[model samples]
Target: MRFERVWWGALSLLAASPAWAADGYSVLGDWPVKATSESGIEAGLKGNLSYDVARFGGADGGAFADDDAWRRQELSAFVRKPGMFELALGYDFRNEVWLDNFVRISGAAGDLRIGQFKTPVGYEESAVSTTATTFMERALPVTAFYAGRRLGADWTYEKIPNWYLNAAVQAGGDLLGDNRGRTLGARAVFNPVKDENQVLHLGLSASNEKRDDDSLRLQVRPEAFLAARRLVDTGALNRVEGIARYGVEAIWQRGPLLLQSEYLRIGVDRDGVADYSADGYYLAASWVLTGEKRGYKSAAFGNLKPRRDWGAVELAARYSHIDLDDAGVALGGRQRDWTFGANWYLGQHFRLQFNYVWAEARRRGTGLDPQIAQLRAQIYF
Candidate 1:
C-alpha cells in the first residue's frame, strides 16, 4: 500500500507538470527532475532499479549451482549550483544509504567533498553509480582490488578555462561499530583540453586505512556476537588491510567512431605477510549507427553531449583482465568479458540502459575456468 501511494503521487505530479502541456504525456519529468537550468540552486532526483540474472557454467558450458538471481534498487537526489557547491543523497538496496558525495566549499578553483562516496583514484571510479559500465558487475580489476567507496573529502580545481584538476582524501571505516573509525586516501586528475568536441583527461590516486577494534566487534550478526568477541579476545581477527589504487582512461570521439581505454593497478595490504597487486585495462570502440551521441568519460574526454534532442542511441564493447597475486595468498584470478550495450535518452531527466555480458573467470588454484553470463537493465533520471 505504501509503495502504491508513492507511485500514485508520482503519477499525479507528472500529469500536472508543465511537461504534460495540453497534448498528451511526455517522457520529460515523468517522475524525478534533472538539472536543466543553472538559475537558483538546481535540484533534482534520480533513481536506478535493475534486475540481474546470472548463469554459471564451466569452460565446457556445464552449470554451477551456487549462482542465483537478484534485484537491485537505488534512489538519489542532487542539488547543484554554478558557483561553489553540490549536495547529493542516495540510497542503495544493500541496507545502506547515506549522503552520497556531500562536498564542502573551497576556494576559486578547488572544492571539497566529504561523506561516503566512490573513490576518486580510478577514472571510471567517479562515474555516477547508475551510469557506469556493466550493471550486474563492474570491470574485473575494479571488482577484485578496487576499494568500492569510502568516507572522505575531495578537492577539485578548474582555474583554467579549458583545464581541470581534482584531488581527494578519504577515511575507510568507523572506529568499531560506533562510527568513530576512519581511513585515509587521496587522488588527483588533470585535464588539458576540455571542450564539447574534444577533451583530454589524466589522473592518479591512492589510499590507506587502519581499522578500529571496536568497529570490528560489530561486523558480525547478533547470533555470532559471542564468536566475534572470542575472536577478538584471542587476537585471531585479521585487523588491518590497506588499499592503493591508480588508473587512467582515455576516450575520443570523431565523426561516428567512439573509442575509449582504461588502465588500472591495485595493491592490497593484508594481514600476515601475504600482499597482492593486480593490473587490468580495456580498449573499446563503438559506432553510433544512427548518428547519435555516445557520451563517454576518460583521460582524454569527459561527458560530451548537447542539450535539445529527442534522444540518442549508442552500441559499445569492452575487454578487461586482472591478476591478484604477487605474494601468493592464492587470490589470483583473471576474467574476460564480451559486452554489448545500449543507451536511450528520455530528454535530460531520464535514461534507460540494457547490457548483456558473456564472461569467463580463470582461477589459479583448481586450474578450472568458469564461464558466466548475465543481463541487466536500468532506468535513471
Candidate 2:
C-alpha cells in the first residue's frame, strides 16, 4: 500500500514490453546456487527466509491465535560489464510488519522493477509462499486477492522458443479515492509437455481493476434476494464500477504423482446499480514416498522428472472451494469454504507445513452462520 511520486513516474514511462525467466528460484525448497561464473561475488548473492504460525477458532465466538514473520533481507550485488546486466536490493518484512523496500534492474532482454511487488493473482496467488506451494493456507479464492508491495512494472516476452509471456501494471494507495485507479495484468506459460523426465503444463490469466469505490465489488448473498433487487433495476451500479478477474491453470507431472488445478472468476457492477458474480477452484495431490525422482522443477506438475531417491520424503493433499453472489443486489453476504491440507519435505531446501480449515457463512437474517477451525505451521529459508 505504498508507491507514490507520480506512481514512480508512471512505471518509469511504460513501454519496454518483454522479459520472462521464472522457472527457477527457491529457498525453502532448495535451488538457488547458480553463480559459477559471471565474475563471482558469489555471482551477486541470492535470498530467502521465512517463518509462520497460525491458529484458528469460531463456533459462535470466533477463536484466535496468530503470529507471523518473514524476512528477505537484500541480495543480488552486481553483474554488468556487458554480461546480461543486473542490480537488485531488498528488505522484506511481514507480520502486519509488512515492509517492502526494494529496487531492481535486470537484463538479457528486459527488466526494470521498482519496489513493492507481488500481485498477479491466480496460480496460488502467484506462488512463493515460502516456496513452491503445497498449502499452508492460500486458497479462499487465492486469499481474497491479498496484495504485495505496491508500486509496479513487470514485462516479458519470448516470441516462441519454448513460449513465455507476462505483463503487470499498477498504481498504489487508495481504498476510496484520490487516485487509486489502475491495475491491469496478464500471464501465459507453456511447455506443452516436453521430455527428459516429464513435461505438460499450461497457464493463462487476466485482471482489471479501477477500484477506489467499488470496494472490490460483488455482494448480494443474502440467499439471493430477488437477485439483489433485480441488480438494482438493471443498470447494475454503473456496470460494476470496477473489479474484474480471470484465470486458468493445470499440471500433470509424469512420475511419483503430482497434480494441480486452478480456476477463478470475479466481477461486480455498481454503476448499473448492483450486479455481482464470483467463482473458485482447487485440487491437489502429491507423493514421493522415498522413490525420489520428482524433478523438472521439483514436481508441482509437469516439466519432467518422475523418479529419484534420497532421504527424500513427499506427501501432500488439498481440496478447496469458494462462491459469491448478489444477483438481487441487496449487496454482499454469502460465503463458503471447505479446506484440507498437509505437506512435508525434508530434502529440497527445508519444509514442514500443516493445515486443517473449515468455514461457512450465510447472511440474510444472520442465523446458523459461523464456523471456523484453523491450524498452520510453516517454515522456509
What are the lDDT scores of the predictions, listed in order? 0.50, 0.49
Q: List, residue by residue over 1-381, the lDDT tens digit for candidate 2.
A: 111332333233221211111334322234555555655433444444544443434563232333333323322333333334344444433322233334445466655555545556676656343355555555556555434444567665554655667777877642222335577777787877757666676777777777664455333211111111211111224444767778787877766676877888776555746456677677777666655444543113311122221224456666655555455754334455454554445434444444444455544544233333222222333
Best by lDDT: 1
List model 1 lDDT by residue over 1-381, tens digit each: 322443354445445545564566555534536655745677788776654434445563353432323244678888777565677877776435442656556567577767766656555555534444423345555444455566767666666554445555666542122333455555555556555664455555565545554212111100110111110011122433654567776666665566767777765566665555567776777665556454443232322232434445557666665554444444444556656665544444444444454555444444334344443334555
Q: Give the top-scoring candidate (TM-score).
A: 1
| Candidate 2 deviant stretches above 4 angstroms | 1-32, 36-102, 105-117, 120-131, 135-140, 143-181, 184-208, 211-238, 244-269, 277-309, 312-319, 329-346, 349-381
lDDT of 2 at 174: 27
Assess the local accuracy of residue 377 in candidate 1 as a C-alpha lDDT between 0 and 100: 35
By summed lDDT, the worst window of 10 consecutive residues in model 2 runs over 224-233
lDDT score of residue 22 within candidate 1: 51
As a TM-score, model 1 comes out at 0.71
Per-residue error (Å), model 2, residue 313: 3.9
Clashes of each: 13, 40
RMSD of each: 8.1, 20.8
**lDDT at position 307, candidate 2:** 28
